[model samples]
Target: MKIEQIYTGCLAQGAYYIVSENEAAIIDPLREVKPYLDRLEKDNVTLKYIFETHFHADFVSGHLDLSKKTNAPIVYGPTAQPEFEAIIAEDNQIFEIGNIKIKVLHTPGHTMESTTYLLIDENGVETAIFTGDTLFLGDVGRPDLAQKAGSVTQEDLAGILYESLHNKIMPLDDSITVYPAHGAGSACGKNMQKETVDILGNQKRTNYALNQPDKESFIREVLDGLTAPPKYFGMNVAMNKGGYDSLDTVMDRGLNPISVEDFESFAEETGALILDTRGPADFHKGFIPNAINIGLKGDFAPWVGNLIVDVKHPLLLVADEGTEEEVITRLSRVGFDNVLGYLKGGFEAWKNSTKEIDEIKRISPAEFAEAFNENSKVIDVRKIGEYSAEHIDNAYSRPLDTISDWVSTIDDSEHFFLHCAGGYRSMIAASILNSHGIRNFTEVEGGFNGIKKTEKFPVSDFVCQSKTL
Candidate 1:
């Protein structure tokens, strides 16, 4: 028997592959299904089933396409009412895959249909548990996400999760391995450990949620400090519940190359968003006049999901050479299927064509410190938590995540210098400000990390009361 955890770093998500006696099963696959298909073909194994822990809200799952291709039925736990055909397994039901067995544990906390799959070997010894969003290494899934869809309060979900963990999962043997859907950097759970796999016994002792003595305390602890989920979460859930466009179709539409003339014309005709997925430094040097820069290196998909807001918004791409397909695949992972195409010949084509180009004014940290010492306004575009921890003195906090709401509040006449924890987020902020026609600003190169190294500016560690200048 072989069990493999296919971890995707960008999404902080894990998909599992299990093989027993030439029969295999997949759990929680990403949008792209070709890799899974290739693996099965290479191993000469027949896919028996595709298991989903829940209807995910973060990324669109590949269950539909995988099932269609392999003739494998998609399986979920009780109370899951997907629009498509699926087998809703009963709690504790046993499924046979060649020499092994998988037991369904109806753990409905992250969502009404959330379930964990327990793998039992040929000898009937319980082994690993695939605890989707129900349990992370260091934290439990947030209960607030399913309130609207399940028609239950977050408190109600939290209580159910408590019962699910205690009654269904915690009672299992300590030797069992725990494989979760997501790790750290995922919005699914707060305080998740960076490690994807852990022993169940270790989680019981170390995870804060698992140690909670009562349901009430668990609910309060889980719900505290949950910032609002990204706006595209509900849209992703809807697409997952109901079916969505095939990955082939999304890629075919997005990977088409368009000349600079057609790119501009398409933008003017359709008003599609021009997303530049280059590095932060390259983006700051020169880009299309209104292109939004969410670099491919940083948290690209989540940032796109947060800032774009609409899943079906027609988008045109300006990517580095040979990376157009990668950009499209990543976009499709987040349910952004309406991508029009990419700029043919890359951004250099536009520059060569004598097209109107815009550039962001980037200054060194020393230059920024010198400017700030004079009569310059500074805005630190880091999160409130980071701002409160330590920030440059007199610099106001305006996070890049909330840029849409507060972009209008910035005075058009005043010049503001922007910086984030690193240079990536500052470029994103600068692009957003440029799109809003507020271009009278200079971005600090290397952001606060570089700024703190220069002792010319005063850095305050105390929490500040006001965030706005």
Candidate 2:
């Protein structure tokens, strides 16, 4: 059996393409299915199955599109409550395509209908187990996500997770390799190691969740340090429920070619979101009021998704005319097809037009130090684990994933200052606060590293906060 792990760093997701002899199956599909299909076609393998580890909450999956395009069945665990059409895959249920033997294992930890796939070679030799979210290289999936959505309590799901870990995953051969749907930077797991893969024996010996003193203890530890999943998670889940219509390519968004006067009219009437995709520094220097600052430096799709897109408004992007196609393609990959059009020239055109703009201030380390002591409060938007491990003393912290809640914890009357590991989340978070009329704010340029390098921190060095910044 041959397997390929496709990693999407933007979402920190890992999907699989498993092939043996002449047939293949793809697992935990991203919204775009053509990439997987292209692989199968290029490899001369017939596509046979599309498997979803579970009804994902983080991003939309392409299971429906794959099934529709290839005439392959969408496979889910027997207990899955999927709204769309899918085969109810039962535990130990076996199917074959060419020489590949597919065995389904109903692992109900991450979600009620979570399923893992085990593959056998042409000679009937068991090869590996695709554990999905049930097991990861160093950690296990958080029990909280699917439970609340499915009307299952965390305690109930934790019980299921314990059983899945001990009874199903643990029983696999020591040599059986394990594959998971999520990796580092994903909210699904608390401490996923930075490894591409792992063996059953290795996980059993080293994975903290797997080595718990007892099932109860494991569940407690697993949920304790979790950063809340993104606010868009549930929205994505509902979207993938009925299944999504996939894109062929970047949709040919017609350039309506509005006159400059008409562009301003639409900006006033239709409420087009003008995204200044320049540098954060440039945006902070000057840009449009209500124009969100999503610099091209970070992962474009997710930042755009988190900051801009919704089921609500259409977007008017402003990129260097050179990056127009690049912007469209990235946004399309995330299912944000609401691109009305792009600004003709760039911010320079806007500046020339006397279009109104706003500026976000990037505070210096000394300025931040003064703010840290006197001017304003600091907000750390790093992950929960990262914050708890070590952080700027007495600063308000909630990971970027939990920004919605982060604000709720603080009184809006008091100004909230924002910072992240680097400058990414700080810009995003500050943009959020700035929109809410919290204007007396700024991000410590380069975040903690910037603050550290520019001035001696008032505290000690615990973990490597990166002078490499």
Candidate 3:
């Protein structure tokens, strides 16, 4: 079998392509199907089947488009109970594509429709299994999504997931390799491996959930550890059922260079919030006063949600020359569509205009500890749920998304020392606070772990966050 791992940098999603004999099957395809079609043509093969392990919750799937374009049979579990059309597959169902033997295993932990496909090469030896979100490398898929389209609870699904893992997924051959749909940056599951490839033996020994003493303990631990699925998940499910409306092509739009005088005039008239997408090193050197510095090097969208800006408000991007299209794409992924335009010529244009630039105060962990001990009010800007699980000493929790509502809770009488998991979310949090007429805000240099050694005391006791886990 010819297997290729396809990673979509646009959405940070991944999929698999399996080919045997003269036929090819795609598992968990993205919105754009042309690339898959071209692959088939290039390899001198015909597209036969497209499989969606489950209705995806992140980006839209290309299953429908692949079916529409190729008229190939689309397969999903009979109990998928999806909103769209498909040929319902049953457990233990076997089919031959070229010389490849495909076996469908009904594993309903992540979603009712969730499945894992076992493949045997023409040599009759088991090779790899496509295990969707049902089983990840170190962590299993979060079974906390609402089940049966809208009727089931996360606990209900999690219970079934327990049965599925112990009874079905765990029984596979130790040599069978595993391929999951998403990786590290995916919200689908926390603690995802950096690489998608994992052998069953390796996963069996190292996967925490897999190491539980017994079934009951396994159920409790797996279900209790999940973070809340993102808000956009439901829409993505329906999108896959109906088929994703993928971009035919990414259009590169250019922004003309603007002088500082022009930028100032535009900012005053349009009131577009300036978005900086450069790295921390570049941003800390100099920036437009009051501009938010949530760089695009990391997951920029989720943090966009944490931004206190009103979604109804407009935004102007300060991305470098090649990143204009990317900034727009990532923002749209997170449901932010209010982008006005980009700052032409980037920082160089501003410098050429001779406008004064300001540097945001970035501090090391040691300095942050001394300041935090003496006079600073530590603000953890992660979600309320994350803050509850683990947090720093003397840190007051104001979730990134809802901070504007609780600004008054802070005395504004102390030095504001802020941090998030990494620096990205903190940068975003700092930018939000700065925009809200609050000054004296300093973003922690390394975020939580970067300055972790500076702790004057032990990490604070935590509570079970309500909404997430």
| Ten contiguous residues with the weakest lDDT in model 1 | 460-469
On TM-score, who's better, 1 or 3? 1
Model 3 global lDDT (CA atoms, 0 to 1)? 0.74
Question: On residues 360-392, what C-alpha lDDT tens digit does candidate 3 reach at each position?
Answer: 678878787666653446778776666767787
Q: Where does the lowest 10-residue lDDT sum fall in candidate 3?
A: 246-255
Clashes of each: 0, 4, 0
Q: Taking the tens digit of each residue's C-alpha lDDT, what string does model 2 give over 1-469?
A: 7789999887778899988778888888887677988998898988888888887876778787788788888888778877877888878999786777889988887888888888777888777888778887898887887766457887788889999878877887888878888788676777888886888899989988888898789878887766555556666767767654455433455233344455667776877776667776677777767667677767766777665537335777767667876666566555666677777777777778866777787887777766666444667787655676667766665666555545545555655567887787678777666666667656777787777775554543234332210
Residue 159, model 1: lDDT of 94
Residue 151's lDDT within candidate 1 is 68
- Computed on alpha carbons, the lDDT of every model, listed in order, comes to 0.92, 0.73, 0.74
Q: Under the 3 Å rule for N, CA and C atoms, how many clashes does model 1 have?
A: 0
TM-score of candidate 1 versus the correct structure, residues matched by position = 0.97
Window of ten residues with lowest summed lDDT in model 2: 460-469
RMSD of 3: 5.0
Error of 3 at 291 (Å): 5.3
Residue 131 local lDDT, model 2: 76
Candidate 1 wrongly placed segments (more than 4 Å): 149-151, 462-469
lDDT assessment of candidate 2: 0.73
Score candidate 1 by lDDT: 0.92
